[model samples]
Target chain A: MKVASGLLAFVLMFSSQAYARQTFEVDLQLEARVYTENALQSEQKDASLSLAVTPEWYRDWQGGAHSITVTPFARVDSADDERTHGDIRELHWQGVLGQWEILVGISRVFWGRTELLHLVDTINQDDALENLDGEDKLGQPMLRINYVADNGSSTRLFVLPYFRERAFPGEEGRLRPPLPVDDNDPLYQSGAEEKHVDWALRHQGWVGALDYGVAWFSGNQRDPKLVPGSVVPVMTPVGPRLQVQSLRPFYGLMDQFSVDAQYTAGDWLFKLEALWRDEFNSVATALNPAIERRDDYSAASLGFERTFYGVSGNASDIGVLAEYLWDERGDEGSGFQNDLFVGARWAANDVAGTALLAGVVVDLEEYSQFYSVEFSRRIGSASKLSVEARAFHDVPPEDRSFFLVRRDGYLQLEYNLYF
Target chain B: MNHPRRKINVLAAILLSLVAGTSLAQYDGLSAEDKGLAIAREADRRDLGWGDSSATMNMVLRNRQGDESVREMRNKALEVADDGDKSLIIFDEPRDVRGTALLTFSHRVGDDDQWLYLPALKRVKRIASSNKSGPFMGSEFAYEDISSQEVEKYTYRYLRDETLNGQDCFVIERDPVDEDSGYSRQIVWMDKAEYRVQKVEYYDRKDSHLKTLTFHDYQQYLNKHWRAQRLEMVNHQTMKSTTLTFADYTFANGFDDREFNQSGLARMR
Candidate 1:
């Protein structure tokens, strides 16, 4: 509640005092979902409804040399009590002074070119409470500087002062960890903890037909390790005592060197994202004390996308995408390692702006497939309707990751209104 | 059949002979194709140096059933030394689509380079030329149509001269040399006095009538260059049309080459 008020004040102040002006867009989304099975033994129903609202504002000033953008978002879910949330998605100021550019405040930065693997996009913490898709992110506080070279290349330096913890759903939420993640009991390897100042440097340029960006980041890991720490028996006033479980979050220091590039030639778009990361690679357990160590691993992804237009004698277009994911850890790697992803996008290009996307990620070792189908169309000039279906099939128990959410596959329908 | 009619015919025959004699003498040094090339070259020369220009435009699209929609944007163009102009368009309105900007580095040789910045994603995407024939922002104007019109892009042939809207105009048909071009040929009419394009008819790749565009309300800027205030393009097959109203024409804005590149797209607004 305090953060909400502070954001409102900031927006009102900026909008009122600026000599220039900005354009505003408001988007409201109403989502409904039906789970294939109950979240737990005590859940009454399998269907849920939710609402999400987003307002975006941006403007340029000082002869268009400077700009500021603000976007605030909030959501409320009817069935999933833990899904109700709000946050400042972005509030940043950017300005160009001669050959140097400066940016301050909260921002979100994307670096990878591939569709599935975002190896170098490590700026903001994912809002995992929303869904497994990593598109949504919470605001990150940082100060950055960019220097432009005469040869059309640029180098940017980032100084991140605050760390944002990745959000997780409650125990009652489906497709979640077996035990609740104790977000409030976060622990850190570094003494600075949440106040640790992490840093990153990136250089981007174009070479002939290909454009590439190389990035290096060293700081705390965005992913956390959940450890069962304390368990206590609570005394009840009347009948029986209840046993409660407590979990602690641990973040490790990590260093990542990554490169992402794209080559554009006519209708074909080829992209690659590769990374070498050093961190604690294994999950630590109370019984296995050797899990903590400085380990290095390598991973990469390669993909190509092609579009065919005027399909079926209409103005529609269809794009086919295929990518191969690789991880050096082999059997020790997560479910994403050694997987093949193939997808297709069908754009009707009609007045309704109808579109459909179907994709599947198949594990090479076990042949377990995570498939999804998404379709969307505009209801009018300001509103859009989207439907999505997801399924998981055929997985051995040793593929422990895929086996967890095997029954969490479901369908979702969403409507969005934009102003 | 009658004495008066014979006299009138004799007079008309003499006048026709005189007109034919003058036309033959006028083409003594050139063939029909050469004459067409010369006229196109002259038209290109006349539009050579306003140096740079910028304008705000409102585009209105209408469907076959009379449904209407609108888009607002601003365009800035810089004339390259020996190549086609570099142009950038910044969309400002309809709210949701605002802050979208497109930068194009048109060239007289090969293909034009283009980029688009999506505001919602804060990402700049390089546009491939394979879809250059696609409609721009769902308007009647295709992406290729908005690129700088270069002289080397087309081959010209002289058609004829006719009076359109009380102005004497030269009509010529030009065929695009680009293999991926959606159109087979285009016929353009230029006013003889100002060398301003007054109308154009586009032929699809199948050599079928596709669209017609008419320019109106031209005004001279800086007393040396003419800029059309209104342009209307109607698709013959779809029965849909789009009209663009241009305003706030400014020239010699001191925009450098640095401001027309892909890096400048995000700051256009």
Candidate 2:
């Protein structure tokens, strides 16, 4: 928190400089969601409303060779207090010197080619409360140095000094497990905990139609293991005694190597994202003796996308996408282990910029299915409207992840105003 | 991405056709197609030696009701020695799309390579450049209409010579060779003095008149290249129009290939 405030002060100092070319803007979003069924958890709600505001300020000097951007975001939710939060989406100063570029402060970086899963994009911690799609990320503090070659190849080195813990839905939040997670008490394998410094290196280049990147990261794992923290006995109408336990997040240090590539051929794009990780004390062994330690794991996602232009002689395009996801841990891995994802995207290509995307992910072993649809269009010059729906089906009771959200189907609507 | 440079090239071709004073009678006995090819070659030759250029553009799109929306962007181009030009475009307006950019590596032949950088996601995505007929950003200008026009992409024929808008012009008809092109053919009017294209009429696949584009306010840069400051494209069928206003045209900037690559796109200001 001190670092965040210090960066804010630095950005303010730069923006106050009269000679700097500065611009300010804000985005306000109103969102509402309705569930199709009642939540299985006692504190969950069937409907919720949220409002988010993000303000951005940017200043550039030295003829754009040096610049700084500051964007801070805050949200308020009616249903879940945990969902209401604040974050610095971006607050960074960037400098370009001939073939070299340097960035300092907090920022977000995405590194992946596949659509179904982003195994290689691990720079920022996931802001899960903002969205379930894993697209929203919290800004990470770092010092980044990048070098570019004449051939368009680039190598980036990152020194991350702090780690941001991933946010989860609260007890009153929808799409959460039966027991709410207690984030205040998190366990870490490293004594330095969240203060452990992380490092990452990536080199990316393109050859003909193919673009590829390889990266190495040493840091605390982004995804956390939920272990039973405390149990309390409660009185029930049908039973004399029942025990309920809340989950605690556990972070472990790990080294990950990842590679991603995309090959473009006409209207078809083939993409691949693969990663291998060696973990130390992957789980809280002292807390959960029944769980076996996972020392190493490998995961991969491969996909292809094909777009058909002017479908049916109209100014619209339809793209079909398919991918296969695999994890060496199989059923023990995330819900995406051994899954197939098929999706379709449609764009109207009109002044309104209308678009629709729909997809389904099916587990190969348990036959559990998750379906999603998203449609968005520009409302006017400075506003947009979006609608989204998600549903789960045939979720096996034995599946630990999907089973939690089996009855949490929902429809969401969002309106954004930009100025 | 390089639409500004492409637009300049379109105007440059027109200026060259008028500047080069080649004798027309040299091809008196040749077929109309050969004469047209000769004229195109002369225009291409006269437009060389530009090296590199950059410009800013303000695009206005108007619907049939006359409601208008504006878009602003910056473009930088590097003239490749043996191949087509490589260029980059950065969007600055509509506020929401600020910092979005595109990079293009056009080829004299075959498909061009293009990439789009989305700043919000911090991702660079390679997009298919095969949508030559699709509207660019919902504007009346199609992708093919704004891309760098290589002479080899079309077959030309000299139709006739006439006076248009107080200037003597040579009118020509060109048919696209790509089977997937949205146009059946295009008719161009090039001024006799500067060879700058004053107007273009497009025919759809059904041979129906679709759109007409007119250039205005021609200016000479470096005393060698002619650029149209304003280009208006009107879709005859939809009664909609798009106008592109260019400004701050700078040439001979000595841009290297590194400046036109994907890395430069993300850092475009």
Candidate 3:
């Protein structure tokens, strides 16, 4: 409550200042989803509707040398009660001082240069409830400083004070596991829990056609391990039985070093993202009684995109993308231990700005596959309409990662309005 | 004692040759192409030494049906010594693409380097520079149309002189040296007094008249550089048009490599 009042006062002060240049905007979206098959869980719905809004306020002073931005987001969902939520996406003040730049407050930062997976991007936790693409992120409270160089290089240091746990879909939501995740009962390896301080440093530079960055982060890991929670008695047709009703989120402490680079040559762009992670502690799993200690592992995602311009003598262009994903721990570490992704993007380059992207990720060892397609076009100057679909095929029940989502194929449509 | 007379004689010879060289530098004994190249060189030379500049632009696009849309942007440019030039353009309007910036580093002999900064994603993506012929923002202006036009990109031929807008002009035809260019040749009308381009007629790859560009509201900056405040481009094939109106043109802003770098694109306002 005090923080809210303080933010209000800060906004009022900026608004009252005559020298400040203020701007405000809002984005509203209406989304609907329809499933192809019946949900595995009884409480989940076949179709769902949602409405989301994001409003932003910006004030710039001293000729853009200093500025403040406030963006808040809220959503109401019809199917899942837990999916209906609100968050402060961004509330930050940025300033420039000689050769240095400073930013304070909550902000969202993105890193990495790959298309399929971002192995090096770990600054903010994923907003899992929103989408499965992993592009959406929650705002992180941080203090960042950047030192800019003349040769297209930058060194940035981040000091994050709080950790935001990733949110999961509720029991009534689709595209989730059979048992819902118990977000309320979370376990952490860090004694400080959510108050743990995280720090990251990254230096990025470019040489001719190559752009590269090396980053190091030490703190709590963003992705959590799912463990079966306490058993609860549930009434059956004949009698009552004890069953694990939910999955508890377990976060561990870790140190990670990552390297990302992109090379641009004519119409081809080559991208690579690799990371090495060292966990400080390990815990026991529900299925395995013995405590398992995790060893240090390496992961990498390499890809390339080649674009063909002026196709058929029109303004349209098409690009082909391919990427390979690998992890040292194989299936035990990540779902994409040994996977290959191939995709294509078509840009109409018309007045309405129509575009389409379709991709498929195939697990090399398990033979499981995930296919996705997305198409979007501008409705007018301030509105856009998009359609997205995803499906899973040829997944074995023993596959630890994709079996739960094998029957969760969905088609979604979204309309966005900006004002 | 005799060295003083010899020195005086040598000095006289040097001064006489300097006066004679100025008179010999005219178009009397030159070919049509050589004269055209000389004029282009003079125009490029006169526009130098500004160091850096910044401007705000309002681009209005209209289609055959008369539907219109406006795009607002800010641009900053730095002059390089031997290379083409560095420029940064930040979009402001259309709400959707607000805060998006494009950084360009052009060269005289090769493809330019371009990066696009997506504000929502906070990601800077290196784009394929092969889209030089595609329309910019769905407007009549292609990507190459707005890029820095270096003298070495075209081969010139001097045509007959004519009067455009009641000003004496030198007409010239230039063929693009780049094979990927959408146009085969362009006929330009540059005023004789200031060497400023007044009008241009673009010919498509098939040597057909494709578009016409006209400039208006000439303004003088730094008492030497001439800038056109309004530029109108009309596509003859599609009957579509785009008009660019520049305002608040500031020169010598002290901008360095920092503002034009790809890493700084996301931080641009």
Candidate 4:
């Protein structure tokens, strides 16, 4: 919290400079969703309202060489208490000197090539409360330096001094763990706990027809292990209620090396991402593992995407995407091992930006399947409407991955107005 | 004249005449194709040395029902001595599309390289060459139409000289060299005086009329080159049209090759 305040002060100091030119804008978004089922059976409501306001201030000085951006965001959710939160999304000062550049403060960084899973993207912790797709993230505090070579390749080094815990849905919220998690009690292998200074080095460039990124990270893993802490039995009005206790998030230190690449030739795109970790837990082990041990794992995913332009002689495109995933841990792996993911994206090249995407990820181990379909289109200049449906089938009762929420599927209709 | 100076002038004149004679003889072939090739070569040679340029552009799209939308952007280009050219475009309007940028490296023969930077995701997307035929941002213009058209990308033939709008112009038909191009051929009208393209008619793969583009308001820049102030394209198949208005043209911006690299795209603003 002190670091966040200090960064806020620094942003204010730069913006207050009389010689600097400052610009500010407010990004207001109001979204309402009508779900097909009750939210965790906690209420008689089938609708949820979410509002997010992000105010951004940018101060550019020293001509085109120096600039600072500060964006703070807050979101309120009426249905789920854990989804309501406030955060400083980004507060960074960037400067360029010759062929070198530097950035300091909290920032969001993304690195990946595929859509199914981001194997090489581990910079920031996932904001799970925002969505189940793992597409959103919280800003991370870092000091980064980038160097450019004459050949167009770039090298980046990031030094992270703090770690932020991931957010989870409340007990009353849908698609949550069986019991509520206590965010306050966290255990770490490092003596410094959350203060452990983590760092990463990355190099990005093109190799002939392939654009590639290779990175190595040494830090406390972002994903946490739920260790049972304390249990309390209470008497309820209906009966004696017995519930599990608070869970401590355990952060294990590990080193990960990853590489992601894409090669586009004519109408086809070839994508691949592979990584090796010192030690990490998949959803199975991290949740209900009979064995109390884990080992280093290696995983890789390869995919290809191709599109048929002007399909049926109309101004539309349909893209076919298929990928195969492999994990050395096999069935004891991340549940994505030996699985196949195939999807299609339909695009209507019009003013409305109409599009539909549907995909299914099939587990080869147990043949359980999860599929989703999403359709979205712009309603106006600053508004959009979308519908998404997700379902599961043939999921075994003892499958650690899907046993918890095997029946928790819903369809959602959302409308968002942006300002 | 002094004996040494006179001797030197005589030698220089002889050498200059010999070079000029050889250049003339090189085009002495009787075939009409040779003459057409020479004319195209000379047309391309005239616009060789403008180092760099920057321009602000506004694109207006109108549908058959007369519904209209607008997109505003800025473009920067750098000339390359070899290979093709490198250019960048930054979109500034439509609120949602602001800060979006595109960087393209056009090749003289094969497929060109392109990348788009999306600000919302903070990621750079590598666009496939097959998308070259698709409409640009849902406009009437295709990706290839908006790109920097290099002289070598097409094979040209001199059709005839005609008068259009009371101005003498050369009519030329050019076929795309790339087999994967969406355009079968393009017929262009170029002014005789300036060698600047005035109009073009495009044909699709089926050899049917596709779109027509007319350049308007040509003005001289740097006292040597001509810049079109506006370009309007009409799509005959869809009954849609788009107009691109160019303003604030500046030349010789001292842009170096290092600035056109892909890694520098996001930092351009």
**Which is the better candidate, 1 or 4, if ranked by TM-score?**
4
Give the TM-scores of the predictions, in the order they appear: 0.87, 0.91, 0.92, 0.88
lDDT of 2 at A365: 88
Model 2 TM-score (B-chain only): 0.90
**Residue A3 lDDT, candidate 2, scale 0-100:** 100
Segments of candidate 1 deviating more than 4 angstroms: A1-19, A38-45, A229-247, A280-289, A331-334, B1-28, B92-96, B261-263
The TM-score of the first chain in every model comes to 0.88, 0.92, 0.92, 0.86
Local distance difference test scores for all models: 0.80, 0.87, 0.87, 0.78
Cα lDDT of model 4 by residue, B45-122, tens digit? 767788899899898989999898777888989888876788989886554566688888888878888878876656
For candidate 3, write residues B70-159 as lDDT tens digits. 888999999999989999999987667788999999998788989999987789988878778888887888898899989998899899
lDDT of 1 by residue, A25-67 (tens): 7888899989876554354346778999999888876445678
Model 3: DockQ vs. true structure: 0.60
Error of 3 at A354 (Å): 1.2
Determine which window of 10 residues in candidate 1 chain B has minimal summed lDDT.
B19-28
TM-score of chain B of each: 0.88, 0.90, 0.91, 0.87
Q: Candidate 2 vs candidate 4: which has greater lDDT?
A: 2
Query: Order of all candidates by DockQ, from best down to worst?
Result: 3, 2, 4, 1
DockQ, every prediction: 0.26, 0.50, 0.60, 0.48
Ranking by TM-score: 3, 2, 4, 1
Instruction: Give me the runs in candidate 4 sitting further than 4 Å from their true place.
Output: A1-24, A37-46, A59-63, A233-243, A280-294, A330-333, A416-418, B1-32
Please, what are the lDDT tens digits per residue for candidate 1 over residues B1-269? Answer: 56998899879767985765223233347877787777788778878887999999998889999888777899999998789888989987554557789888788877777778887656777766567667776788877777788888888988998999999998999888787778899999998878889999999988999999999999998787898899999999999999999999989888776576556776667
Interface DockQ of candidate 4: 0.48
